[model samples]
Target chain A: MRRGVLAVYQVLLLVLLFAAWHVLVKLEVLSAFFFGEPLQVLARIWEWFASGRIYPHLGITLLETLLAFVIGTLAGLVVGLWLALSDTASRLLDPYIKAVNSMPRVILAPIFAVWFGLGIWSKVVLGVTLVFFIVFFSVYHGVREVSPVLLANARMLGASKRQLLRHVYLPSATAWVFASLHAAVGMAFVGAVIGEYLGSAKGVGYLILQAEGVFDVNTVFAGVLVLTLCALVLDWIVTLAERRLLRWRPAGPGAAQS
Target chain B: MSPQPALALHRVSCRFDARGGGTYVAIEDVSLSVAEGEFVAIVGPTGCGKSTLLNVAAGLLAPTAGAVRVFGEPLLGLNRRAGYLFQTDALLPWRSVRDNVRLGLELRGETDADRLADDWLARVGLGGHGHKYPHELSGGMRKRVALAQTLALDPKMLLMDEPFSALDVQTRALMENELLALWSQDRKSVLFVTHDLEEAISLSDRVVVLSAGPASRPVGEFAIDLPRPRDVSEIRLQPRFVELEQTIWQALKREVLRTYQRAEA
Candidate 1:
């Protein structure tokens, strides 16, 4: 019964927000040209789905995001583990790594376009750059933070160096990597959309860019709403995977009570 | 013919670089041995480097001086013939209870890892808890899983560093009795380290005491004449047990007091 009340309150909040948006636009407190009508934006989104006009664009964006996420995550895991285990190499490369990670990676989108020539590969490259650093740092710290006692115990139990890497280091890093994946996924989407917005023939970002050029505020809002929904869905999938993999963890207080 | 000691540390010393740019000796000239199938407990004041001595025997730390021998062979790298029960929670948090127990066998690439894990878990009295994770269990249960994990490989020697110090008194005694029962069956060499004098006397065939640290060494040793198949809780009531405790505490009290004075200074 409490959950039902919470659900009703949640829906009421969104309804109230949209109602306010509609009222302000109708009263001319906010310009319809700039903000767009709430009903019109919803209708535009509905029409795109009803006519299946958003499928191809959404598919392209999602494909780019997924490819970027997979390649970036794999590269980060391998490089993070390698660098973390090798002390001298990590020490030597420390400053360089910090410099590279600190740069505004969004600026790479235009350069990637120049190199990969406005194709899906350019967007994928940009997305990979955005996702890689988040995972890399997380995994690096994870491997370094492994409990020394646990390592010693494993060694005494006769674990070889290779076995230690596989059983101890990798699993410990995996937990940290999973924790960073939600942000990494969001970064991947941002990279792909920004790449498309800058210069692209396809993707939801391109559709929004086209609508903006023609002053179709409703279509632009519709495109943004669609991307937001897709990002939420992807994040939900990640949370589900995290739950399945991390069943060994004790549930937090909020989850335990529920 | 006499069998060689299961593990021997000869003139062992460990020095650490202090944060203040000077060297600090953790243990100095600490020689000890555990005979085959013998249970030897090392008792000392807190911060007396007892765990450091155990680490040396386990081959996890290389001594600044002296040598370690395992079954009359010079030890190298890790002590492959020994298992270590750490004081802290060393069980892999990502693995379930059964998987943690199977870790040693898995490292060796044994084919029957699952069966061995299940059998050892049952032996440790965690038969129905194989599926639960470490966080789901109580502190005593986690220690049992750690014990099972260490013993699953059937190592010839066990090196435990205050393994039950974190548990409550009742749980600690119960686990001690269980460990004694298991040790009686297998008869593996054990080097148990703890600050609790009663626990050392109750559980061990012999107790070795170390002096206060900066550079700690063995100050005294006593043979416990208690009979076999002893219950750790009930053993303390025996007159002989009390007498032994008194004798050992006389040597230990001085070092413990010296440590306290040093700390105060």
Candidate 2:
């Protein structure tokens, strides 16, 4: 009963905040042209949908984000596993990898545009670069942390190298990979949008950049809101995948949802 | 029992690099033989290399010197013949009870994996519980699954490193009985390691006692003439069981005192 009441209370708070914003705009205490009233923004969003101004942009951004996310995560996981399992590979590449990771990735946005042209490919390249390093570090650490005792036990049971990786190393790294994915999703969007801002003809980032150029603060805020909502949806999808994949994990840890 | 011992350890010694300074000797000049179907237990104070010997026998660790042979075959590079029941359950947390049992067979490329897993799970008294994960099971259940996994491989010998030391007294007794039943079906050569003298005495056919560190060796052995299909309650009452327990305890007590004296010096 208390949970239900809290849910209602949260909805009520959002409504009250919007009502106050609407009243402030009506009294001219807040400038409607600059900030826009809550009702005005809502009408603008509805107009966008009815006139088909939003779908193509939304589609382009979603496609770029997803393609980049898949490519980046897979590349990171495979290479990370290789480096961790091979002592020689890790020793040789350790310093170089760290140097690359520490360098600023955002500066590569304009370079990606020049390399891949002003298309969705440029944004994807930028997004993938951003998402790769986060997942690589997490997976590398996870594989290294596996207990030597457990490895010995598996060997005694006659597990080959490939079998050991499948049974022990992969499962150990899975949780870390899933955690990295949550953060990676946001960075993926940031990379794509920044790429679009620099050179793309479409996508949410381009819309925001155009709004900024015109000094239309209301449209700029709307673009920000749209991107935030999309990120939340992507995060929710990743969480669902995590729950399905990790069904074998025992309950009663800190895994229970609030 | 074969004329040749199921497992033979001849003048085996292992030296490991210690962090602080000089090299640390884990096991040295330890020589013993366990015959087929014979249950042998090694007891000593902590850090006496009892577990290290078990690891060598399981083919998980190489001895710095000497030979360990399983059924006359040198265990120099062999790892597929013996099964290991670890001190910790070591059950994969991501696999269900049934899947954990199937892991060994899956790695070995066995076709009838499910059928083999079911048989082992039933033997371990965990029959109707193939779906539960390790977290859902109690400590004893996890250990039982670990045992079942080892049994499924049909190993020629079993190397257990204090497999039940983590259980409560009552649960441990029950598991010991369960172990005896499993051993009775197809008597595999077992080299069980433990610090508990009474446990070593009640379960094993021969108890091999070890001395303290920096090069510990086999110090004593007792043959348990206790009858087969032994009842846990009756086994405790047997005159021979009590005598063997005391003998092993006495051997262990002396070694433990020496270890403390060496540490302080």
Candidate 3:
């Protein structure tokens, strides 16, 4: 009953906040340029959509995020596996990898922009850098923690090196990969947004930057809402893929009902 | 009754590098052999290097001294003659029952994995559970899947490390019976490792007792001579089974004490 009441309360709070927001703008408690009326923000979104001003920028940002996510994930998987499998490589490069992972990667946006230009490539490189280390560490830890007893059993059963990788290492690493991807999605967005913020001439981030330059706080908030919506949608797709791939996971309440 | 030895270990010794200067011996001066189609069990206290010996036989571990051979070939370079059944079922949690059974066959590049896996799973009384994953099965069922997998390859030799130790008493008995029946179909040479004296006595043609570590060596070998088809119910009843169990226990008891003493030291 408490949960049900809380759910209703959440919706009521949202409505109340929007009402208060519109009232403040109408009463002149907030400036139109800085806060804007809620109705105006909604009107601007529809206007941008109808004029097709939003589509091209949205498309570019989406493409950059998707490409960077895939490239970063694949590169992380391969390198992580290689490092985990080789004792000498893991030992030699572990400290350097740790140092690089620990550093603030967002600070490299200007450097990436200079290297790859104000195009989508610079955003992709930045996104991949951010996503790669999180996934690499997860996959490496997953593979390393594989049960020795299982490995011994496989060896006794005549498993080849290739077979061991497929049967054991891959399955073990899969959980870690999924966990990393949830974080990676947000990082991908950050990479593209930061890239546009630093230099790009066109992107949702570019639109947000333009609005901010003119002190248009309402438009800045509008860009944030758009990005958040896109991230949630992408995260839903990833969750679906995870469900299909990891069916071996014990049936949850969802499966029980089905 | 004349055939080559299925496996032979000559003065096998395994040593691990310790944190200190001295070496830690897992096994030392251990010589053993199993004849073709014979079921031999090795019993020892914990830390007696029984697993180390099995690994050496499977060609996974290299002995610091001496050599292991399977079917007249040195185990050092051999790839696939031995089948190892771990203490845990070690079934791939992500795979279905049939897939777990098909794993070894798939690794060996056998194209007929589907049909073979079906047959083996049926043989283990898991005919309709082919699509169910390991997490969906019970402990005994998981071990059955592991057994079916090992048997699917038709290995020349089977090395089991406490394969039934994880099961409940009733399940263990049933598993032992299933194993005996499977062995009867085509008696592959088996080297089973266990700490259970009765288990070692109940299933083996011969039982080898080993001393406790840092350097465990064979203490004695007892040949089980009760009867053929080795009646599980009758074998327990036999005076010989109890005699062999007691004898092996007597050999193992001192080693168990020594192992504990060493730990405290």
Candidate 4:
């Protein structure tokens, strides 16, 4: 019940901030050219939605983020489990893994663009690179963190090799995966937008770049607002999933109701 | 002739390559056995290789030397006929209490795994708490869940490493009583390792004392000759129980001091 009230206030705070922005611009306290007119921003967004012009761009950005997240998470889980479980493999590849992970992976965006061209694939690949490491490191530590006692207990309980992976290893690793889900999803979105901002045929990021070129502050703000909402939605979805999947986790950061 | 012992370790040893330098011999030439339906406890000072021996019995760790035999068969890999109760919180936190109990049965392809899990849960005095997760339960409750999880498998032997060491005096005694009640039912061979001499004497048919680390091994053994269905708390007040403790403590005291002096050094 208190949360229900707090949620209303949260929306109220957003409205009050936007109202202050509108009133400030109306009184000439802030320049509409730079700060942008909130009303016009909302109108532009409505216009884009009404004409359905924003759908394909929104679709492309959303698709890129999603594809990157799924593929990257899977690749990270498989590779992380393999390397972590195998003493020889992790030792041999240790330095190379460190080198690749430490290198500024964002710099690879241009190369991905060249390889995949100015399409959704380039952005998706960029997002995957960003998401993969975050998840890979989490899974690596997670698999290693499987309490030796617990593993031994499972083995003594007659769990086969395949059963160990499914029951003991996968569940343990997924806890670490859920802990990093928000950051991974956020990075995926960042990768897609940064990829698009650098050069792309369509995406909300592309629209913002186009608006900035002509100095149309209203469209730029609209695009920013749209992307912000999308990020919030994705985070909400991650929270929901973490709640359901990690229900057994002691309530703390990941499973916090608030 | 008598039947083969349920578990036997002849001249077993464990040596670890210390992170800093030379091999650390945790235990060496440790020979022990638990006859069929016997409950044996190994007690020693803290840091003694009591747990290492238990691990060897569970087949979780390979002995550096010598051999481990289960029912006259040379053991290999994981012990197929034993259930191990770890000292630490070893339950899978992600699974519900019932699911944790159900996992072993399901792995063996039991179609009625859920029913069996519920039966074991009820047997462990946790009949209504099956839906609860490990983290949601109190420490004692979690221990009960672990007990249920281990016992549900119906293993021929149990390898317990200070399983109740973490519980408070009250909970520990309660669990000890429950364990005795259950063990009396089937009388599975038990190899329990602990530092508490009282706990060992109260729970086992025989108590073995280990010397301090750096080649810890059995230094003494005593048969309790305690009667059946003994109450752990009540048995302690008996004159015979006191007699056994005094006898074992004399031999065990020197080893405890050795461990202390080694630590001080």
Residue A147 C-alpha lDDT in model 3? 88
Worst 10 residues of 4 chain A by lDDT: A249-258
Candidate 3: tens digits of C-alpha lDDT, residues B128-148:
999999988989999999999
TM-scores of the models, in the given order? 0.97, 0.94, 0.91, 0.95
Candidate of highest lDDT: 1
What TM-score does candidate 4 reach? 0.95
- Computed on C-alpha atoms, the DockQ of candidate 4 is 0.86
Candidate 1 error regions (>4 Å): A1-5, A253-258
Model 2 Cα lDDT, one tens digit per residue, B130-241: 9999889888999999999988999988989999999998999999999998999999989999988888878888888899997989998878878788867569988878
lDDT of 2 by residue, A71-102 (tens): 99998898889999999999999999999999
Candidate scoring better on lDDT of 1 and 3: 1
Task: Give candidate 4 misplaced runs (Cα > 4 Å).
Answer: A19-30
- As for candidate 1, its clashing pairs are none
lDDT (Cα, tens digit) per residue for candidate 4, span A78-129: 8889898899999999999899889897888899999999999999999998
Question: Candidate 4, after superposition: displacement of residue A204 in Å?
Answer: 1.0
Model 2 interface CAPRI class: medium
* TM-score result, candidate 2: 0.94
Least accurate 10 contiguous residues by lDDT in model 3 chain B: B73-82
lDDT (0-100) at residue A151 of candidate 1? 92
